[model samples]
Target: MLDWMNRYRRNRMVDHYITQLGPALRKRYGLREQYTVPQIQKTLVAIHLNTHYLAYAVALYRHEASRNTVNLRLSQTFLDSLRAEMAKRYFHGRDSYRAHDVLGLVKTSRWRGGRSADGVRSWVAGAAD
Candidate 1:
């Protein structure tokens, strides 16, 4: 069906980009064990903050694919383990109108622009509270 195909293409096209983003994410979080993008996605959903992760993932994927990077990384809780790994960085409010929902503008420090590799900035972030 066209619907199924569209959905699949819409979602699948980014899988590669997300995988390419793996190193940046692991390095930024100082992760010891390697994690696939979907595994990370599941973790975000388990914490009930997957929506933020999805939006940010799309944005970061776009950025990596030569698209745009105007989207904000929304706020939400995360696992304490990930929290401990990522909290040392600065979290800036990206949107004043939705100040409470804004988690700040984060950029990985290893990309071409000297930002990205730790892509939780525009790709992943947070606790599960």
Candidate 2:
């Protein structure tokens, strides 16, 4: 019984945090939609490459943005937080690393930090594969 209770507690805590992850990412990662599976996969890869610290933050962000999170405005605070998290996860071999794991970072960086909604639409149009 005690074990069950402990597991339940852990799951609940995880769920609670998961619920908050999306809003936080959306607020930070410039919530947008992935028109293609490859783009979606890449963005997911970017988050994974990053610290992935926010306990399902990616999922939450995806849900909230309705897959169009990138189309929405992003906050500097969010981008900074993401960059810091990525720096923590980034290693010496990061250049060879796959960008999909941290799709958010790749998108932001590739755009040179100035691509508007249209730019994102173009990226998403690519095949997710």
The TM-score that candidate 1 achieves is 0.23
Give the TM-scores of the predictions, in the order they appear: 0.23, 0.25
Of the candidates shown, which would achieve the greatest TM-score relative to the real structure? 2
lDDT of each: 0.36, 0.39
Task: Report RMSD for candidate 1.
Answer: 19.3
Total clashes in model 2, counting residue pairs 3 or more apart in sequence or in different chains: 24
Number of clashing pairs per prediction, in order: 10, 24
Model 2: per-residue lDDT, tens digit, 5-59? 8767654533433333323434454545412323433544544433223322333
> Alpha-carbon error at 72 in model 1, in Å?
5.6
Candidate 1 lDDT score at position 73 = 30
Worst window of 10 by summed lDDT in candidate 2: 58-67
User: Which pairs clash inside model 1?
Assistant: 24-117, 77-127, 77-128, 78-126, 78-127, 78-128, 92-104, 108-115, 108-116, 109-116
Angstrom error at residue 98, model 1: 26
